[model samples]
Target chain A: MEVVHTIADLQSRIKAYRRRNDQAVGFVPTMGFLHEGHASLMNKARSQCGLVVLSIFVNPLQFGPGEDFERYPRDAERDLAVAEAAGVDLVFMPSVSEMYPSPTRTTVSVSDVTTRLCGASRPGHFDGVATVVSKLFHIVQPDQAFFGLKDAQQVAVIEQMVQDLNMPIEIVPCPTLREADGLAMSSRNVYLSPEERQQALVLSQSLQIAKEYIQSKSSQGFTSTELASLVRAHIETAPLAVVDYAEVLSYPTLEPFDHSHSISSLIIALAVKFGKTRLIDNLILQVRK
Target chain B: MEVVHTIADLQSRIKAYRRRNDQAVGFVPTMGFLHEGHASLMNKARSQCGLVVLSIFVNPLQFGPGEDFERYPRDAERDLAVAEAAGVDLVFMPSVSEMYPSPTRTTVSVSDVTTRLCGASRPGHFDGVATVVSKLFHIVQPDQAFFGLKDAQQVAVIEQMVQDLNMPIEIVPCPTLREADGLAMSSRNVYLSPEERQQALVLSQSLQIAKEYIQSKSSQGFTSTELASLVRAHIETAPLAVVDYAEVLSYPTLEPFDHSHSISSLIIALAVKFGKTRLIDNLILQVRK
Candidate 1:
């Protein structure tokens, strides 16, 4: 695998690839501390595309004030090895200066969808994500880009941006990977202490319970409010897990679900903090036929 | 020349062009009533690129409430003839429904630079330009895009956006085309009555005086404020001309210039209303040795 750092070099590489023949390029953009979740996205890209490019940059714009930007774990050597093993053709590891040599005046902002969930918890987070992703998309000029469904709201925001801007790249959303104990795999998962890690399973557990409840009672005219309360009640069973938000919202749009919304349209998502580490997990309920 | 109306057709056409071989694609995006200024941009694109694509979109997002969006002049048959004559390889004329099939939730906005000059006069105008330009850039996938220097602030905003987002396309700023009387050519010029059109000469005349004043006295430490007042005084000579904004500011950044700013870094721009028809013009002063 070739590792490129500069934007000009990467464009030349992609150009060379394009000149050789017609081959679809796939891109996976990440913040570096690679794990199975990232690997899953790369693997998906590898299977679907002729060329798979992965970018590992800890974008400072995405982090808010007092966020874990400083403490964010990064191991470049390990990340490179993981990317190579996952069949990534090119790895773009740009320095902070290379990515943002000067202050950025342009902002890619999505309205309405960003007013809920993670958007509320972290201000300016989705705008930063949309902007950086836009820059990366232009830099790579990929036919398709892979995004992990772990950040479902992020996936939705990016989808909105792509559609709104008429970007020709397809967004392939891979399913979220999980730990053996049912905790959702996150780069920030490393921040969890032994006790916190154990308690983090409550996030996935609550989601699983919500899924089961929807499956069992979807035919009985179960409303979104009832499902949300049920999910909240399940998470409350774990002593260490402090609920930040537990609600059911309309998928894609992330609008609050009313009785008129179909069960299939509802997504039950939750964010809970165990000690200092916050974890989020969600499940899209399948409607009963 | 091929004319494409749908997004899918345009992408396929661009794809076919890319498939042929290595060729630099040049783009010129405009609102439809093609004038001599737009033809100049097309001609520039024709000379420099292997293929030139022109997009005519009368974007509604750039128009505020009570603005001339509905009354925006469009002559598709004339525009097509002009583009073809100028050697445009492809023309994209998408309908409003086709360009914005749904409500746009995403916006590409540039700050600081957008807060002055025309931006102050027409709120959200640059955001609309940036967003639509971004969409066209993605849709056409051009290697270079052309803009007229008459809309100098628009060019600066786009330059900032392209740089900030790392868009690979080159922004080629063509010189402003003017009539025999020195009035800058614009699609909106059709709105002017014969008398209003005659009075509109003051817009360019004022800019000319500012350029000469700066060129003559720049070595003697001419200030931006002094030049702005000079231009504003010149435009007040015309009976039909009502000054909306006549000011000299720093180039590209569009910030108010202080004594520390060099003479070459300044751009003198003006917007004047000739009766109900608004016209704008600018002149970039050359620094004397």
Candidate 2:
């Protein structure tokens, strides 16, 4: 796999790629510390595309002022190895200065979809994500971009942006990967202490419990309020897990369910803190008639 | 020349063009009623590129509540004739609904540069320009995009957006085309009355006067305030012309010059209303060292 650091180098490489033939380029953008989840995205890209480009940059824009921008986990050697293993054709590892040469004056902002869930919790977080993703999309000019559903709201925001702006790229959303104990895999997982790690399982467990309940009661649907409470109650069992937000909303739109209409699909999202590390997990369920 | 109305048709046509071995597609976006300024852009695009794509979209997003969106001049047949004359390979003339299938939720906005001149007079104008241009760029995926320097602030905003967003497309700024009477070529010029059209000469005349004054006293640079007044006073000489704005600022950045530093380049921008029709013109000057 070829690893490029500069935008000029990557662009030149992209030009060369385009010159060869009509190559379907697939991109997987991530913050370094790659795990099985990132590997899945790269592997998925490799399966379909002639060229798979992976970008590893812990975007400072996505983090809030008081959030974990300073000490975000990054392991370059491991990330490159993971990329190579997943058969990534190119790896773009750009520095903070490389990504943002100057203070960014242009912002790609999406409204409505970005006003709830994580968007509400961390203000301007999605704007940062949208702007950085836009830059990456322009740089890569990929045919299809792979994103893990671990950040469900992010996927929704990106999808909305692509459609609204008429960006000619397909957004392929992959399923969220989980550990053996049902905890969602994240770079921040390393931050968890033995006790915190054990408690973190509550996030996925609660989501799973909520999913099964929704499935069982599919015929006679529970209100959004009822489902949210059920998820919250389950998470509270774990003493260390502090519920930041546990929401039951319409998938992709992130809008609260209108009780009058039949709920076809819903995403039960969770953001809970265990000690210092905050872990998030979600399950998108399609309600059966 | 092939004329396409739908985005799908354009994409298919673009794909066919791309398949013909690394064809350089140049784009010229305009609000119909093609004047010599738009023709100049198209002609320049044709000269440099393998294929030229012209889009005539009278974007409503740029117009303020009381502004002339409904009255925006458009001549599809004439525009196509002009495109063909300029050797444009394709023309994309999408309707309002076609361009915006839904109310646009995503906005590509550039700050600092957009806070003055026309951007100040017409709020959300640059955002509309940036958003639609972004959509066109995505849909067409052109190698280079052309913009006439008649709308200098617009050129500055687009250049900043392309740079900030890393839009892998070259922005070629063509010189503004003018009538024999020195009025800048604009689709809106059609709205001017015969008398109003005569008075509109004051817009370009004042800018030209300021340009000569700056060139004559390049060594003894004038303050931004002094230069603005000179242009404003010249425009005031025309009884029918209402001075909307006449100001001098640093080129591209649109920032007011500081007397602490020696001035190098300045853009004398003017917006004057001749009856109900507003006309704008600008002169970009390079200080003779």
Supply the DockQ value of model 1: 0.94
What local lDDT does model 2 show for residue B41?
A: 91
DockQ of each: 0.94, 0.89
* Candidate 1 residue-wise lDDT, A42-148, digit = tens: 99999999999999999999999988888899999999999999999999999999999998999999998899999999999999999999999999999999998
For model 2, which pairs clash? none
Clashing pairs in 1: none
Q: Write the per-residue lDDT of candidate 2 for residues B108-169, one digit (tens) a residue.
A: 99999998999899989899999999999998999999999999999999999999999989
> Second chain only: TM-score per model?
0.97, 0.97
Off by over 4 Å in 2: none
* Candidate 2 chain B least-lDDT 10 residues: B257-266
Label model 2 with its docking quality class: high
Candidate 2 chain A: worst-modelled 10 consecutive residues by lDDT: A257-266
